[model samples]
Target: MEKFTKISGIAAPMPMINIDTDMIIPKQFLKTIKRSGLGVNLFDEMRYDGDGNEIPDFVLNKPAYRDAEILIAGDNFGCGSSREHAPWAIKDFGIRCVIAPSFADIFYNNCFKNGILPIALPQEQVDILMNEAQKGANARIEVDLEAQTVTTSEGEVISFEVDAFKKHCLLEGLDDIGLTMEKVQAINAFEAGVGATRPWV
Candidate 1:
């Protein structure tokens, strides 16, 4: 996973609530275990028509939001199934942060594991960011995981809360495997001792 210290980029406004994991990447796309290449299918149903043509009105389909690295969404974001692919799709799409009034517990935790910052802010604050994101590419939003702040293009700063341990993991680019690798030397030593003692087996 990539380190997420700070992100300053375009924010796409997605005001619809209850955006479930299926709506993010769809069930059909979940067959593969690989995390890469899901970005093209992110919000697949919403971004394409039955014919697979890009829908003009979808926020992500719009030219201004095509490269958005942050998302300002409505309440209950990432609700439904606990599939980890949701965050993978979001991250693969280059969205480093998702700001919403609230998020599903499993999905929220999964975001941290996948190097995506899922921010739960008050409704009022989310609304403010949503409006700012509507200004298109020119309006850049900055998210600082270290400072726990989201600054709007107009210079308005809103502070958010994140678990200290999660923050550290993201800052250091440490996923579960990465965390385990940190103790590789100790693990190797223990394995060697076990091999010596249990050689008969």
Candidate 2:
């Protein structure tokens, strides 16, 4: 996981609500456990047509939003199954932050674990960001994780709340594995003691 301190980049607006796990990466793309390749398949169903051609109208496929690092989405974003792949795909696609009116609990938690910032803001604030995102590549949005604030292209600043532990993890780039590694010396000492005492077993 990469440390997320502050990011200022293009934001793509996806106003449709209830964007579930399947719609994000689709079931077929779920075979691989590796997280890297999923970016191309992020929102696969929406980004491609029946013949597998890029859909021109999809927000991600549009030229302006192709490199968007933030997403301004509608309410109930990431609803449905608790597939971890959703956040993986989003992060792999280079989206570091997601701003929505609300999000499903599982998905919201998953975002933090995967180094993606899932921000739950009031509907009015989300609407403001959505409007700014609609301006395309020129309208960059800034998300300051340390400050817990989002600044729009026009300079409107809105604050958001995040869990303290999750915030620390992101700032330090500590995922579950990274967190465990922090106590490597203690773990090694414990294992050595156990081996010394229970070698016969």
Candidate 3:
């Protein structure tokens, strides 16, 4: 996982609520366990038409938002199944933060684990950000995990809350595997002691 300290980039606005896991990457793309390459399929169903052509109206397909690194979404974002792939696809697509009025508990936690900041702000604040994002590529939004704030292009700042432990993990780029590695020396010592005492076994 990459460390997420601060990011300032384009923010795509997706006002539709209840954007679920399936809508994010679809079921067919779930077979692969690898996290990379999923970005191409992020929002696959919405980004493509029946013939597999890019949908012109989709926010991600629009030229201005094609490189968006942040998303300003509606309420209940990431509802439905607890698929970790949702965050993987979002991160792979270069979206470092997702700002919404609210988010599904599972998806919210998954974002933190995958180095994506899932911000739950009041509806009014989200609306403000959504409006800013509508301005396209020129309007850049900045998210500071250390400051727990999101600043709009017009200089409006909104503060958000995040779990302390999760904040630490993202700042240090520590996923579950990375966290375990931090105690490698202790783990090795324990294994050595066990082997010395139970060699007969």
Candidate 3, superposed: residue stretches over 4 Å from native: none
lDDT of 2: 0.94
lDDT of 3 by residue, 73-157 (tens): 9999999999999999999999999999999999999999999999999999999999999999889999999999999888988
Candidate 3 colliding pairs = none
Candidate 1 lDDT, 1-201, residue by residue in tens:
899999899999999999998999899999999998999999999999999999999999999999999999999999999999999999999999999999999999999999999999999999999999999998999999999999998999999999999999999999999999999999999999989999775
Query: Which candidate tops TM-score?
Result: 3
Candidate 2, TM-score vs. the true structure? 0.97
Global CA lDDT computed for model 3: 0.94
Name the best candidate (by lDDT): 1
**Clash pairs (backbone) in predicted model 1:** none
lDDT per residue (tens digit) for residues 53-140 in model 2? 9999999999999999999998999999888999999999999999999999999999999999999999999999999999998799
Off by over 4 Å in 2: none
Q: Give the distance in Å from residue 31's predicted Cα in candidate 1 to where it truly belongs.
A: 0.8
Q: What RMSD does each model have against the real structure?
A: 1.0, 1.0, 0.9
